[model samples]
Target: MTRLFTVPLAGAFALLLAAAGCGGSSTHDSTGDASVTIRIPDPGNEGLLALGKKDGSLAKALAVVHAKVAWTGSSGPFAPAAQELGADKLDVAQGSITSAIAALAQHPGFKLFAQIAPNKTGEGILVRKGSPIASVRDLAGRKVAVNKGGTAEYLLLKALASAGVPAGRVTRVYLNPAQTAPVFNSGQVDAWAVWSTYSIPEIASTGARFVATGGQIGSQNYSVWAVRNGFADAHPAVVQAFSRYLHDAGVRQAQNPASYVNVFTDAGPQAVSGTARRLTIQDLAQTAAPDGIRPSNVTDFDAVARFFAEQKITPTAVNVRPYVLSLTGSGS
Candidate 1:
């Protein structure tokens, strides 16, 4: 079995301290240890982090820097994980570009260091098989399930705008990730705005139809890895090592997609098929870039912030540069 540790989001802070060897010490100094805590959403499907954990590759890679990892499971959306990173309870966390931007607006202490491959194919607006909602424009006055304040909400807004639909025309039903499929299937919501892991499975099992995809709206949903500013400053080497590890993993998965897909099915629930897993992994690998955040990424993030502000999703526009860290020469 994989040696990754799983902790509930509520008790993550206390476990973070214990993982860092700060059990009895009052001093909050994290400079002396090479240990780090990373929080990943529960690997319900085969994400990169989940694949790495299942194969022992993630743990082995971290050991290269003599860094111990305390893996924590985030039960809900990326917002809570961002909160944990801001409170200094987590060294690193994974989130979407939209969520990361929103988090940075509130807590500039978090810096995006790297991004996973983009998977636009997995993101779309899903409707029941025979639902009358045939297109994004048809969503007016209908209820749509979105994980409010998350990638889903952003995608939905962008998709609607692309279809010439105003944001206020639809009823935005906020639901947790786990609640989306059931609610949509039960007719509680007219449609669901979701990405691959959730959207893919539901489409496969329930014969749902896609009204619009992220690709159709030119929305590139990139899953990103961000670290607390203080943590990155204190442990630059560890960050570099982890970045390389992730990049390498992306390459490996790209080369042998079947292997990673098998790992996911063998290690946990077989919710996704080998074909879907392979396509998702391929999309991630094809879009994987080097260690540092690119200028285009920053520009896109700023654009997302502006969109959020214009839609009243965010209270204000955020400047993304302040929360970006440069790992150019860090040997990543």
Candidate 2:
């Protein structure tokens, strides 16, 4: 019944609030005890957010200043979530700097308040094992599924370019991750340009191999938190406090992702078991260590923007320096 894009933005916002039992509260109380209830997307087996929610650590940390946390909307793509933030329907959500760039190109609503370094080792182009697609060169003239205008397309394009395959040669089938699965499994698409979530699981369980990892093919997607500008301006302390909570939780996950895997991946539909569980744990441990919420690096994002613009993913290049904000308070 709740459609994110089908209804007007205001209507969608109202629906989300009603669905989440939110009282449409946005601003902090005048006393500034951080009593404002922060609304964010429901964390669904999503790394540190899931970890924090499962243990009640996020709420406990926010309660220090009398702030409350509300989980609104289903965990989904960052594109719609970005729109929700812009409309003041939600206060915060997990996003990538690339997604933030794409959002800003369309409209203004949120500013990236914090950043996490990219872990591209596990995000790559997934292909059937022994499929004859030995390298990026083999992708030429083939259909590849990629979510347009973001990391998926970017990674694939970079891989193709590295191998000197003209963009026009390969047919890029624009499909979201959910839509791409069946087509990919049926061999309708030669490869799936996907993030670690799907890539890791598929590789561990299914007989899938990466034509090239993001690292090997040269692509970067930094994890970041985007906050509604209104909320950040109205309650700076709340933002800082919440960011600090996320940073600390990220630290714990980064330190030992294997230790937290039971809770982190437990909520998903399929239980990761056997060899899949072992391999997933290994990949997560390596990828998690180098990442945590941290300060924004404008230069790296500029590179991302330039690539998207060249690929015509964005209407034009977007300058992200203004939106790259550094809120106080984070873990060591």
Candidate 3:
């Protein structure tokens, strides 16, 4: 019999142990069918939610192997539950190149198998549309909000440093994206170092503009699908299947940007405008690869590891070369 372990919701991270859940034997059901419960990290992220429900790529791919996939949202990026699932809890965890790198550096047991979204233009320095701060340099001596430990903070630090903005040139206001939006609009912060998706439109409503785009700063970033070391080892075939589905999703996301817009509109609660829709599509396409999977030359994982090391975010520098799994291309 498979033992079931119940976890309280507030436990930072919960261990979902169930025969059909987490624990038990890694075997098929009584109907002689294999069960594949994929805990897609951050399922509620508008882009990911739409992909899982509408794209059908994940469903279609898993069906061929007789697996039943289930979705769950994490409190934040890859949590302890995700690490535990290793390969099982979440076949694929979607995160920015920086986040993925940081996660791996911290855990040392995680590996990324496929590229889900290119980390292009996901971030920008948000100011009023016609704000005086037209470039990253303009933000010197201004208050900027950065989400600590997230891509926003890492990118902001690098961008500011390159712009020759002295450490004290800008006031660093640490806040989660949620809190930053309000403060940014109220002028509590002079500018916001935030993601384009959420902060872009929010700042736009306030007549705020982008002072710097990731592309303008030559920041090449991408998101990836990650798995745990042991999980992938125990179930390489399952990992491959999940990786393929994610790659296909990227293909569909790229091929039909408009269709994806509609999908997001239908599946998401956010009211995306025509202009916003176009921008979102454009950003999505920027990260799309030919086969939807390839080694990223843009992100220097080692450099990232070093950054984390300096910041004391990770105990040691991680060599990501061995852990990176390549999807090659479609059907690879």
Across residues 1-332, which tens digit of lDDT does each residue of candidate 3 receive? 11111211222112112222345534332234366555555444345346666667667766644565666654354434346545345555656666666666555566666654435566777775556777788788788888766667666766776687765778778886766777877778877777766664664456566777676665545555566665555445455455555555666666766555555454455646556666777766665642223445424666666665665556776566776754443221
lDDT of 2 by residue, 1-332 (tens): 11111111222334323322358554333335546799988776646677778888888867654678898987667888898988879999876677788889996788776676676677878898669898989998899999867678878888888888999999999998877778888889899988876787678767799888878876768877888988766655566557566656666776777755666555357456776677767666665322223334677888889888998888888988677554333222
Compute the lDDT of residue 14 as modeled in candidate 3: 20
Give the per-residue lDDT digits (tens) of candidate 1, residues 113-177: 87655566778898999999878999999999998777889889999899899899999999988
> Would you list the C-alpha lDDT of every candidate in the order shown?
0.70, 0.72, 0.58
The alpha-carbon lDDT assigned to residue 41 of candidate 2 equals 84
Residue pairs in steric clash, candidate 2?
none
Point to the candidate with the largest lDDT: 2
lDDT of candidate model 2 versus the reference: 0.72
Q: For candidate 2, give the lDDT of residue 183.
A: 88
**Pairs of colliding residues, candidate 3:** 18-22, 119-221, 119-222, 127-208, 127-209, 128-208, 128-209, 129-208, 129-209
Identify the runs in model 1 with alpha carbons over 4 angstroms from their true place: 1-45, 74-76, 262-291, 329-332
Candidate 3 weakest lDDT stretch, 10 residues: 1-10
Better of 1 and 3 by lDDT: 1
State which candidate has the highest TM-score.
2
The CA root-mean-square deviation of candidate 2, after full C-alpha superposition on the true structure, stands at 8.8
